[model samples]
Target: MKIVQSTWVRYHHIDLARELHEMGHLERIFTSLPWWKADKESREQHVPRGLITCNFLMEGVRRMGGKLPFYSKGTDAKLAVIHTKNYSKWIARNLPDCDAYIGISGSGLHAGKVAKSRGAGYIMDRGSSQIRHADRILREEHLKWNLPWNPVHPWLIENEEAEANEASLITVPSHFVKQTFIHQGTAPEKIRVVPYGVSLQEFHPVQTPPDNCFRLVFVGQFSLRKGVPYLLEAFKAFNHPNKELVVVGNVSDEIRPLINSIGTEHVKFVGIVPRAEVKRYLSTAHALVLPSIEEGLALVQAQAMACGCPVIATPNTGSETLFSNEKEGLIVEARNPKALAAAFTRIADDLDLRNEMSMACLERVKMLGGWRRYAEGMVAVAREAKALVLSTQ
Candidate 1:
């Protein structure tokens, strides 16, 4: 089957494209950022500079001391509406005819519609929880933290719902995400849960834990949605003499003050490092904590596990698919600092348990396989969707 995929940014779609190409099914990939611009190694043929110009303009505005609409809540909502609408229209016009078209959710509406018109199976790939559920969770989080809640743009939700309605199969990364879609009234039969995979070649076990201190790491954007405040509170409450919290991501302005207010003596903010560096941190760390309130399957969990670093994550992160609770690492409840603190203490206090968990994590990753397995699963789903379409016709 000939397959074409489109995404606004160079996400895991590039990996998907490469896999499809290897399987002799990829026709072309449509992306906002060009492969050359994104990575020196990528040689895939893609529609370049689709929404890259808008991204550059937003960056320029930020550099010029203009609070670009991309940053503010209300302003960002407006920008999202404009960006997705333009990107969807572009995909509709530019996407090539193929047996199947795989498009990322928000930006897939127009392209899916166009693909369906051309008698191609349309697959909408949702990388997070249902749009409305995500928005509600974020809004509640902001309210709980007394921060400004900027709900997702209405147009984006509308577009996603439209895509869901039109898609032959809606692909989600995790059962957590599938549940969200089901809760939001999407048919369970229409949703396919294909969890993401880690790059074992890039993120592998390398570092041994130091005898003196236990190191804990958190990777991803520092926001309420990641349950950062809960993590911070738990880290603070845990009474480990040789414990360190290494945060590796961009700190949002709204969360900066809170981060500052909680003393940063033991917490190291290693802002936004490359993937290689991230692997290094993951390898050396004793445990990776992701107390996320909402997410698809967080790829970092698998990456950390691959690096022999057990994860302390909430079920919302779809971590159950990665490792068994208390085997690879503990699965704690989200938004509960006490549970997080207990999990932290459990790992930090017991040397043998920590070491055993690390070993389990390494073995778990091997069972999960890598990106190639993920690609194969996605292709299987696409073929099934295509077959169904053909049968109906």
Candidate 2:
């Protein structure tokens, strides 16, 4: 089977395609230009260096004066797309000759709808539940941040409804996500649960601490959606003398003042480090804390757990699948600083518990299966879809 994948989500689809191709499938990926290079100068200067590769059709459209469909003539050729709400409609206009297109999440589903009218087999890879789950997180954040409760954001509600109605197959990352979708009016059969995998090579256990402070690292974008405020408040309330919170990510401009006001002497913000450097922080940290109120299956939690560091996350975030409260790692209620503070105290005060949790986390890593497993599962799904198409013909 030949598959073409598209998205602007910064996933290394080339690596995934390579793995699938090695397993006897012809795979081609199509992603948008690097988000950073929206201007003409950046694209011209960087394309030569191969900093980002343009999608076959997008490049042709820019070079030539017309939009042409991708034409590598082969009976087995198939096309898969990552649907984002921003430019999904462009997929149909861009790829007039493709077999199938897929949306990676509900947002993707909204994008895929545009392709559906063009006769593409649409699949929804439910990477995250944008409504039922997002609402839960919104409620939590509202209480913690004292913001207005607007669970049903008008734009998101429209996207969620469109995704449920249009996509033929909806893929979910966890049972929690799958269940949430079902409860939100999606049929159970439409939702397929596929858990995410970790890259063990990039993130593994470390031996020694880098400093005297018991490092508690949180890595990702600094936004309310990630429960950043909750994390800061929890860390502040954690009554540990030797511990420090190392926040590694860019803070949203809106929340900067609020974050700055709460964090004290022991807390330090290291904004947006390189991906390679993230592992170094994870290695040195005693534990990883992700108090995100809204998320699907976060890659950070998986990376941290693979590094043999215990994790403490709220149930609203999909990391709850990996960590059990007082088992593999602590699981706290979303947006509750008091609960998070208590969990932090438990891990910090009890050295034996921390050690035991770390060991369990390693075992959990293997049980959840790694990147290889995730790749194989993807192949199985795609092949099934391919076979169904072939049988009909």
Identify the candidate with maximal TM-score. Answer: 1
Per-residue lDDT of 252-290 in model 1, one digit per residue for the tens? 888888777766768999899976788889988989999
Candidate 1, lDDT over the whole model: 0.82
Residue pairs with colliding backbones in model 2 are 83-108, 126-171
The root-mean-square deviation over C-alpha atoms between each candidate and the true structure, in angstroms, is 3.1, 8.9
lDDT of 2 by residue, 102-212 (tens): 545433553355444544455666566646657775677667676555345445466656766776566666766776887777888766666777777778865544456
What total of clashing residue pairs does each candidate reach? 0, 2
lDDT of 2: 0.64
- For model 1 the local lDDT of residue 265 reads 69
